[model samples]
Target chain A: MAAVDWGTTRLRVWLVDEAGNVLAERRGDDGLITAQAAGFSTILEGHLAAMGAPEAMPVIVCGMAGSRQGWLEAPYVTVPAPIGAILAGAARVPGQRRDIRIVPGLAQRQADAPDVMRGEETQLAGAGLPAKGRHLVCMPGTHSKWVLVEDSAVTGFGTWPTGELFSVLAAHSILRHSLGEQPQPVASGNPFFQRWCEQALAEGGDVTSRLFSIRAAGLLQDLKPGDAAACLSGLLIGGEIASASRRYGKGGSVVLVASGALSTLYTEALGLAGLAVRAVDADEAVRAGLIEAARKNGMIAGSGVAA
Target chain B: MAAVDWGTTRLRVWLVDEAGNVLAERRGDDGLITAQAAGFSTILEGHLAAMGAPEAMPVIVCGMAGSRQGWLEAPYVTVPAPIGAILAGAARVPGQRRDIRIVPGLAQRQADAPDVMRGEETQLAGAGLPAKGRHLVCMPGTHSKWVLVEDSAVTGFGTWPTGELFSVLAAHSILRHSLGEQPQPVASGNPFFQRWCEQALAEGGDVTSRLFSIRAAGLLQDLKPGDAAACLSGLLIGGEIASASRRYGKGGSVVLVASGALSTLYTEALGLAGLAVRAVDADEAVRAGLIEAARKNGMIAGSGVAA
Candidate 1:
């Protein structure tokens, strides 16, 4: 059996043996957007062939591939929904050469704060649903998702476009003048970064007003370009934490599902916000989620073989 | 005498007689940024000459022309400072054919909420300081300044980059997909705009999270492109108002210093927030500011002659 996590800009695939041990893996630039134009079936076949996947090997897919504009729309399953229901309600691609199932996303249809998520649902499932108590899960990315899980069910969630907003502002807005032409990486240990996060958490609200201070600090206080970049990151991430904590009480243990630099930065920020974090590598979690889907559908054996 | 309002992207010059009568007026695209390359003196001279002003005619200039990067740095006059200090601390262009003076901007040097504003201080002076009372002045623009004037002195102010944020998100971010190619104008009367403003004011914080809803509403609710644009405007402006009101306190006579479309939109949003607005034309206010500067310096007589 094979598992795939297809998003807007990238694609990752894992080939597993009958016992669910990873035999091979592949990654490509053919995400849902590119795949839609290049032919989703063709792209999938090319990737599978590159990984030497068998013709009859069933594939379990997740993410934007199930969006309305993707290969086929996998309608959203509304919350407070059980995580396992995503696999149960998976949409099977029709008229395919090989068996392929796409996991459904979760939607919050509350009229005042309507929201939807695609790929993050799988991450949540892979993180393991908390069966006994309420848990706060933070998934940071282009669109960061702060989700609430209670007794294996996702009660509600909020999406923050922190990464996307930071990118756009850093590249195109006047804030770019403060942050130099080259993209600057925000490290957790940077004091400027830590200070900004602390300030944001302390300030509590007036985020838009605080955003202008990044530029002002640069102009008036001679803030370094690298520090400006870090400050921007800290302010955005800090605002996300503050807002999410306010909306969803910040008492529970936080499960941070992230990878690479983002994981480190978020871990540090959550610590500053006075919350203990349980870190989970996003890559492994997504693969685990895909394997879970395949196992539930009897495509892959539940027991795993030694690598 | 002549009055000039030279900002980043546009330049407006008014030729006035000694009695402060507008004899002729000219507008050009030679703003501070462009004028830096085109020669500020040449641009100012051409506009003055186009209106057939004498080379000896004294000119009172305001806005970005006084910044450190401009033709001559006027330096910032720090606040809890009187608006009249802007005129007294004006920077004069040396070695020029005409006597050109640029009004200095006001800077709030508070460690936590440091901010600076150029061009708007002249408008405040022109608007006439509120006598023996606290006035909340909302100056809406690319960098909107919500100034607190207590008994004719600027106690403090907050700058919200609402307009710039809106432009960048609508043009460069994923939110652009929901908003059409051509930039849509957000009318004051748009119900979609009104609802978003009300919602933003009601849900006072967590602005970054609310921004994501614009995209979600479009995806799930099939929000129209025009309404999406309006909602974006409402969300930003509403967020600015909410944050500013929180920082400055909502009580007081709210003076909205704006003109044309922005004036209408802000006035409507303020009204929805249950604050009665005193609308002041931004154009007239700036002109009044420049005129006040000229009159205070004895360049133009205090009394004005009707055109």
Candidate 2:
């Protein structure tokens, strides 16, 4: 069984033998912006050519590459379903010369607060428990998703444009006057950040107003440039925390699907919002979900489902 | 006396003849960015060339062009007064043959709000007053300023970076994702804009959340992109109006310093704020202020100040 998680910026392909044992894996750029989708075909071909060809090898793919703009349009599955219901929802990707299947992205409520899952459904199936829970799975990125899992079913979820806002404001806003150009990691105990958090918590001030303080702080010697950028970062993330708390916040076992250094920052913010943090490997979840999808569809040997 | 108003992006030099006439004028690229004092040589030379003069002229200069980065490092005069106490502040470009004088900017701190103004002092001086009634001046631009005029002097002011913020978000933010790359005018009285206004008024609702709605509104068939853009503009301006009300609402006489299209927008927003819109010609204000500054220093002959 082979599962591929192809996201905007990165691509990872995993291979499992008949026993579901991980035999090999490869990672490459899947962002497709520069390499185009040609890169994905080349990587898969190289690995298959090196591993020696099997009689039949079925592949399951997911992520942006599955969208209308991706390698092919993968039909989206609506929300509120048991584990197996949506698997039947994926549209087949008719690769010209390769046996390939793509996972469908999900959308709800006309895309306002739409939640999406590219290749993560297989992992949910493997979790075994009913998707039913007051469960909220947070996948943070340029567009952060908060998926509500209930009774082994994919219920409603909210997608906040928080990540994109942070990216643009940090890199492009006039706050850059004080922040300079590059991003600087924020100190954990910075007073400016503390002021930002407390002030936002107390007054729920507009983020724009809060951002202006970066320039003001620098001018008043209240904050240095690096610290000003960090403080702005804190303000943005802190606002995200506050916003998410109110949006996808109802009861549930909160799951944070995070990667890299951002995990700690997000966890800390969640804690600040009084949320108990439990981390999940986002890569593993999506990878696992894709594998189960392949096995369930009989594209891979059923005995290899455990892989 | 000759006065130069050096702004951030452009160097504006007016030749206030001894009779207080703009005998000749010249403009050049930003005086600050070029590292050369356009305020001194090129501008003076241009004026001299235009008027066919070989003698030096006394001038008064203001704006960012006169700041530390400008041709002259004009000191920031504190508020509640019309003119800086210092003599032309620090002249960076002391031309060997030109008798040039630069007007200083203003810096003020009132309780917790601190503000710095450049080039506006010229207008305040031109608006000769009894020093008792309040005059609220709203200067809308990349970084909008709402100045509180008290007794002929600027008591304090609050800065709302609505223009810059709008520009950055519309051009760079994730909001750009939903909007096509093409630039378009915003639709007035559009539903998207109305939604933005509602969001702006929402308790704790930040602009970031409303930003994504641009895409959502346009993509989902309910809102036009132009209208979505307009809503964003409206939301930002609305938010600014709210902030300004809190900071400088004590005034009975509110004055708006804008002209042309921006003036109309500002007028619409002021109407939304339930304030009587009184438009002041910005160019005339600058001229009046320059003339008054020249007259006060006995450099030019007439009052020539208009309200």
Q: Which candidate is the best by lDDT?
A: 1
- Model 1 ranges off by over 4 Å: A303-307, B302-307
What RMSD, rounded to one decimal, does every model reach? 3.2, 5.0
Top candidate, metric DockQ: 1
- Assess each prediction's global lDDT (C-alpha) against the native: 0.85, 0.63
**What are the models' TM-scores?**
0.96, 0.80
Q: For candidate 1, list the clashing residue pairs, or say none.
A: none
In candidate 1, what are the lDDT values of residues A220-268, reduced to their tens digit? Answer: 7888899989988988888888888878986557999999999999999
lDDT: worst 10-residue window of model 1 chain B? B298-307
Interface RMSD values for the candidates, listed in order? 1.4, 3.4
lDDT of model 1, residue A68: 89
